[model samples]
Target: MTETFDLSALKQSLDAAPDHKNLKPLGLQTIYLGRDALTVLPDVVAAMVDATPALGPVAVLSDSTPKRYHAGDLLSFVTGCIDARHRVRNVTVGVAGHTVHADEETLAKAIRDCDGAACLVAVGSGTVSDIGKAVAAAQGIGYIIVQTANSVNGYADDRSVLLINGVKRTIPTRWADVLIVDTDVLVKAPVEMNVSGFADLIATFTAPADWYLATLLGMDDSYSPTVVGLARNQGSALLEAAPLVPQADPNALEQVAKTLTLSGISMGIAGTTAPCSGMEHAVSHLLEMATTKAGNETALHGAQVGVTTIVAALLWQRVLGEIADGGLSRVRVPGPAESQAAVLAAFHTVDPSGAMGAECWRDYERKLARWAHASERIELAKRDWPTHEGTLRHLLATPQSLVAALQSAGAPLRFADLEPSVNEADARWAVANCHLMRERFSIADMANFLGIWDDDLVDELIADAAALGSSR
Candidate 1:
């Protein structure tokens, strides 16, 4: 099922890029790319063990999913160099590495219990990789990431976002010594996971707007066109491979998975989240953080991002049109006094905390107010304006027909199905608290800034979106 590609043409493209001067060592050193790549794990482990001799006491981080276990069959498939003592004395396999909830303490404890392992082989997608990355980095131990699902482009980056002190924070991490992916394993994953990955990938179209916005505000350093171009190309591949997204075609899944892997690495190269995320991601992060606080559990990371990507895409299109029609030039920058009032008006439009049932609303307001005081808040809003627009556009831009296309392909695009989560209130709360999540102003905040964020509008959109989801 491999969709054939011109390998020589790709090589020519690579060659045409001109043996550019090494720009500070780009990307992960170990790339286990290509189909059936995971079958070579033992040899890879043996080689790495030979190289980094200090790498001792291997602890394996595994997932509880049936898919990962099925994928483990491939790990077990590696014919040579099996060490029982290496596994028994040093191995700490956590079935809940990422699928369930293993915090820093839990994971560290597991590794420490395993005779103080020096390396952890993480055998799954983003979550497992994050845990492995964190466990290794925090303990001065290096780890390798085995990608199980092409769900998100998090594997290639040096940053690991985890719950340290009960709050999500991104800590810098080293790259995996080996980036392994059994294409066969990825092929067996639920098609929805693949589609969600694509939706997240397509978000690259809007991220440059974020970079442009950041630069316009004189905040960030230079934005790289090369990295952006790379992201967009990967995104395009995901779409082109959309038709072949199920039952894990080696050719199709390889295209999607490799693009996804490179997308993760692209973020690593960019040294910023902008390469793979935009306002859509911020919206997802806000909901995720809120759900965590609410004691709610179990929402797939990619699903939330997928839904928000749709919304952001729609909003982005709307804003893109306005900007193109001279909205930026026409609108004058309001004075701080006027700006404050407009923002406040926007806030109250959505928040009716004065009412009896608004105790929760008032408390959230306190937090929202604190977020507003951030020094760079307005600048992020102004600069990232168009990308925020693109995020909105992602919503309307992706036709329901496409969601159906994804559905026929087995993807989930609505909120109702996001397990560990079934509440629209979380989505509503996220939209309501838009201004609080990040400094980069998203469409939710733009709705407020543009005088469209009202209880009625928010209510209608959430209800309509959820209804659309339920219908699906």
Candidate 2:
């Protein structure tokens, strides 16, 4: 028997899913946080159709990979779900990427091809949703995300991460006004992918501490822990039910859908990725950019982030421990000149082999140059990290239900398992060079701020990390 999901929140979320809490819509958005909602696609569509004319002429844009996994059937399924009083003028699902191999041009063109799409429905996971959201945002249209898998937490995020010329980039895009998830499909998604999501969700614990650290330094902290707790709790519940998620059982479906929906809403609440990312996310972004360059689709985003989580978690622990030992002085963030020199030097050494194509590196430089001018005054590389490091340790070190869930679902336990090529050197190098990408200070800069950031230090750090690595 399938474990049943607690879907009591669907009614409330549906009635108010469109805008901010203060700008709630009136019965226009609908959500199905239950098992096999996809299989009952007809009902899903019917519920949507009757919800509002605003979504009836919805243009469905998706990457081909998710479409192959039944993303296209969603509109037809929803068409069947609605009452005869509701009418769907037509459901047009325009193919964006091929086999999830989406490109920037394809992503941009998909939105331009919206034709009669009044609102867009994203049918896949991260990649598909990114493309769909960008199109909607550029067109100033509303979007609904129908997640086919629990592979990411950007369902309701206003920003989308994209690959522009094989480089990872974050773009401001429209967030989903409505997030619809069918548990059956998510539980039955590729095992590695689901495990990856498990890792990403758990990283939330570590992420908020980093956010808090920045907030103390004067970054905005309007996001609430209460909203983040919703997703975190749901994620924990799903992890507890990890074994059942991949069984394609109804109970597992509900849990998967609930967690996924909660993740989406958390983005809505935070208005940022504070509820879902941190140094782990930063590391995965680097790996993903490299992977795209190598023509290697090695692992899912969550899987890579999972491996990075432990590394960041350990670094946070050690930094705090050192502070407790009273062996290190509190760090004042380096002056811009000093920090920039360190960042540039680290990137060169890490990229010595030129694994990243020249064109890609050139493009990155151009983008960074453009962004730096406006962001230079922000004092972006924060140095007072040990205190926040202690907080991150509290969040990442504890054995949460997420670790158990990913293990139950057969997710990776360590970096070696995910990237045999990633050695102690690679881990250290990635952390050391982490500064060039984001305008934020994370574990990478924290490691650099500490005196133990040499090759030998990095090696020692990785060795200790590998030794204490947990597959549980």
Candidate 3:
């Protein structure tokens, strides 16, 4: 039987864990989930006011897009709600754009401008919420999230994926003190947005395998089954609700929202994004960077992640096949100089000025150093590949399964299906160069270090993914 997740019960378990004392406080105090969740806005504000009696003005941060409901403007709606009860001044910080970026300049300006605000209530989706969290952390103020859409899992996470020096980096940030998910509001969001949210949650099926692989290779020591299992526990439910997402069914929207929120909390518990982001996320980030550098609009983060998740699943299947065929015994670790040269050369194609390349190497070198120091663990992984094969397979969904899930949710399952339309060449470029773009060690890194991911293998994986897409 599949396990059911109760956030309150899970929080209690986390608090009671023997290592709980060492764990950083998630800072998430309350979650208001249901229809009429917006009604609790005053209560959230009052709680913050009680905690910080001398709290300054409250800033409501949001994008310019209007929600598809009777109360269309999320920021206006929130401001009006807070104005009715609290005498605290509420200021609206509207980031100019339908889609705002989580970059250093934007965040710095938001933080500098909202310096005196004692509380921040994010009134949009993932990007707005992430900006609010970052600004709150910078200003040392409490934060709350009034989610307008089920778009991504960053809502409850303590980390923000910000662009630093043109490369996407997952930086530690603050979690919201309260998270409000109103199903009525979520159901009014664009169906595509809801589908993208479902797609993001689907990554739970594949990301944990990458995390487990990194643990086995000793590249990351912060792996936890408790945290990872929390997300996995909701997998079957999310998949069951996937087909109804396109219709904006309230039940389905609530299920997706709750699961995605739980996913962010899982990241908080693990103190890393590794539990929900892996090689697939690297692929999405690479594609986003390419589009941004080319002066084009990027696709939805979760949409890109969905398509890339299929690719990662296929690559893992192939890697496991190779191991089953005695490939692990033939694995050869590369020298530091060789790995650095490869990373640099791979990155030069993405950025000719070498700045991005240097930034990537700065991070990748740490993983390489860790791998060198943990040579014994590497040997153990090689010798134990067969023993852990079943567990790895269990953690991943098949390519066909991912494709069907994306299709059911009306998400982009292929490059051509993406918004802004990623072509075959760019998608291939992302698959090939994704490992070099991040310091994190994923299946891509493992494949590259083992000499398993080459031009021919990339072509094979691309062909396999394309076939899966066509089969849909």
Stretches > 4 Å off in candidate 2: 1-28, 36-58, 66-103, 164-166, 219-223, 246-248, 326-328, 345-394, 399-405, 419-428, 470-472
Tens-digit lDDT track for model 2 on 1-472?
A: 1223333454365444443353212222445555454454444444544554554365665543432234545445544443343434332233434235346777766756774545556677787787777877776666667777777777656678876555466666766656666654565477656656666776776676666544554433444545555557665577666776556565665665556656656665455665667777877777666555555554677777766666666666666566555523544344555545554554554354443334244433543443334222224423444554555555564433334545676666566777434544455656555545665545554455555555675566556555555524
Q: Each candidate's TM vs. the true structure?
A: 0.73, 0.74, 0.94
TM-score of 2: 0.74
| lDDT of every predicted structure (CA atoms) | 0.57, 0.57, 0.81
The 10-residue segment of model 1 with minimum total lDDT is 354-363
Model 1, backbone clash pairs (residues 3+ apart or across chains), number: 24
- Candidate 3 regions exceeding 4 Å error are 1-8, 15-24, 53-55, 86-98
Q: Is candidate 2 or candidate 3 better by lDDT?
A: 3
* Rank by TM-score (best first): 3, 2, 1
Q: What is candidate 1's lDDT per residue for 92-206, written digit by digit as tens? A: 3344433444456665765465335645677665766876776677666556777777787788777676654333445567667667766667777776676667656655655
User: Which residue pairs show backbone clashes in model 3?
Assistant: none
